[model samples]
Target chain A: MRITIIGSGNVATHLAAAFKNGGHRIVQVYSREIQNAALLAYHVKAEAIDRLQDIDPETDLFVIAVKDDAIFSLGLSLAPYKKLTVHTSGATALTVLSSIMPNSGVLYPLQTLSKNKEVDFLNVPLCIEGPDEQTTRILEQLAQTISNKVYRINSAQRKVLHLAAVFACNFPNYLYEVARRLLDKQNIDFELIRPLILETAQKVQENLPVEVQTGPAVRNDENTMKMHLQMLQDEPGLQMIYELLSQGIIKNTKDGH
Target chain B: MRITIIGSGNVATHLAAAFKNGGHRIVQVYSREIQNAALLAYHVKAEAIDRLQDIDPETDLFVIAVKDDAIFSLGLSLAPYKKLTVHTSGATALTVLSSIMPNSGVLYPLQTLSKNKEVDFLNVPLCIEGPDEQTTRILEQLAQTISNKVYRINSAQRKVLHLAAVFACNFPNYLYEVARRLLDKQNIDFELIRPLILETAQKVQENLPVEVQTGPAVRNDENTMKMHLQMLQDEPGLQMIYELLSQGIIKNTKDGH
Candidate 1:
């Protein structure tokens, strides 16, 4: 399969490498900055192009791994090519690509990606969506080559999944940052909480988060919760978050959901 | 060292096993429920007693591993023994024990413990605080026998650490529950986000949480954030949490802290 990757960011770099390693020919790499395109193109042994006009029209697949807002414009630019196009975004709808190209799909990898960190694509869950059965099947085949888990999720479902990902992956990380700041004020090393964080995440794999939930909030220990709120008295932002989340937990526990 | 564990809860059970494994004699285990105490004592080859009067006064160290509110009363009850006493609590101050017993200290483990799970005490950070230099030294020696990471954190510092932990461990798990509920509504398996959660946590181990923070909140992507808010309209509690946390992230990122 011939592939043309449209972007030079983390997702683009990782997808390009995974495709190249999976025995697919990366025909071209496109980025506004030629240097960025060339860096990823060089690794995949593909041609690097700065403009959308230079994209290989004959490529079997065009993966737009750019930012969420950039996808629609990029799709508009590549509409005339009528190539099989997909965007690696969890938030964007498949219509964003299908409205531009007859053959459109989604190949959203449900994992955090970083340029320096090597991702095990085999373990990453690829959420695929397409307008037609054939388009979905083709994308699924390609996704299965790289990932073990492939789901044919529609645009609406994908959006909800993306929102959940924000809660699961994004919000918790922000909580971690808050934790780091709180520890920093006391001159305590953040490493002390690393084990706890890892174990908390690991628990969710085997047990439901609600069933395994523990802490002052779940236990309804008013004294501890009051003390924690007092500790964050100066930081209104953190205090609000702490209070709301505790209330949410208590309500959820009572509701038994 | 002769030790008496004055509770049979999660922390008490784990601590008793770890101390016994470290070659210390667990002289007795005490609990209001004799069955609970016997369950833990049986594992450590020690006697289980429900009454405080049955507590071995000759024991070198008495560990009060009960609820936060119960610690004070327990300390007062054990004060007549005049033996070294410590409580396994993070939120409670070290003075709570010292005010009751002359030989009071803290052996608060910084990791979450469960009865079913086998804890690697070697990696658990044991926060030790005592009234005097000798008491501190003795607690440190016992802590070193079972764990590699030991800190002489003061009561105030430990309180802050405990607060930070609520954010790091407890709040994040609550966020995960939020994610799970969102996915449940869409009939999406929560397993899909497990990889993302694990990787998000793994990043914090090697990098500062601030440096590695990602998502619409960190990027200040208003479109995605607005869409997520709309999706969560039915869940007002979750929606408020989402808005406040996103605002917090944007402010923190802009402040460059």
Candidate 2:
């Protein structure tokens, strides 16, 4: 399969390499900046293009791996290709791309991507969606070649998954930052909490997160909660977050969710 | 050193086993219920006692491993011993025990402890505090016998560390529970997000969390944030949490935190 990757960002670089490594032909790489395109294109043995007119119309697939807001506008350039165009976004709906391209689909990788950090795509779940049965099947086949887990998720379900990913991945990383800052102020080493963070995530692999949840909030230990709140009094932002999340945990536990 | 473990809960059980494994003599295990005490005592080859009168006053140290609220009352019951009594609590002040026992100190382990889950004491940071330098040194020596990391943290510093732990470990686990529920409602397997969660935590091991954070919130992508808010309208509690955390993340990013 010949593929043209649009965008020179993290997702674009990762997908380009994965496809090439999986024995698919990456025919071209595109970016507004030619240098950015050439950097990734050099490794995949593909042509790099800065101009929209230079895109190869003969490729079997066009993957728009740009930012969430840029997907629709950048996708407009690919309408002339009339190929199966897919966007690698979790938040954007399939209809957004399908509206411009008749053979549009979604090949969203359900994992965080970083340019410097290499990920094993085989374990990442590929959430696929298409406008028609045949298109969906073709996307699934391609997805299976790169990933072991593939799911046919509709637009509405995909939106919810994207929201959940923010909570599961993004919010926790911010909380870790907060923890690091708090310890930094006290001259405590941030490495002290790395094991706890790793073990907390590892526990979820074998058990439901709710079942393994521990801390003052889950145990309803008011004394510790009060002390924590008192300690964060100077930092109103952290205090507000602490209160809201603790209440959420209590409510969820009471509701048996 | 001869150690008497008061309370047979998660912390007590782990500490008892670690102390025994470090070649120290565990004098006794104490609990309100005889069965609870006997269960842990059998593993450490120590006597089990339910009554305060049965506690051996000759022991070198008495480690109080009860709940936060119970620590005060339980410590009063053993006031006759007048030994170096220490409570393994994060939120409670070191002065709380020092006020009751003249030779009190703190032997707080800065890690989450679960009875069924075995943890290596060598990596767990043992925070020690005492009324005097000699007692602090004694606790530090005992901590060093089982763990490599030991620090002399005061009550105020320990309280802050505990608060940071809540944000790093407890709050992240709650967010994971929220993600699990959202995916469960859509019939999506929660296993799909496990790799993301692990990688998110793993990133912190090599880089500062603030430098490595990624998501709509950190990027200030209002479009994705607005869509997420709209999707979470029905669940007001979750929506409120989402708004507060996102706002906090944006504020932190803008403030160059």
Best by DockQ: 1
After best superposition, candidate 1 residue B18: deviation in angstroms? Answer: 1.4
TM-score per candidate: 0.96, 0.94
Q: What TM-score does each prediction get for chain A alone?
A: 0.96, 0.96
Each prediction's Cα lDDT score?
A: 0.89, 0.89
State residue A61's C-alpha deviation in candidate 2, in Å.
1.8
- List the lowest-lDDT window of 10 residues for candidate 1 chain A: A111-120
RMSD of each: 1.6, 2.1
Q: Which DockQ values do the candidates obtain, in the order shown?
A: 0.81, 0.73
lDDT of 1 by residue, A1-257 (tens): 99999999888999999999888999999999999999999999999999877776888888999889999999988888888889999899998888767988999988877777777888888999989888889899999888898888999989988999989988888898889888988899998899999888888887888877878998899999999889888988888999999998999889987
The top-ranked prediction according to lDDT is 1
- Docking level of model 2: medium
Name the top TM-score candidate: 1
Question: Model 1: residues >4 Å from true position, as ranges?
Answer: none
Chain A agreement with the truth for model 2, given as TM-score: 0.96
Overall local distance difference test of candidate 2: 0.89
Q: Clashing pairs in model 2?
A: none
Error of 2 at A254 (Å): 3.0
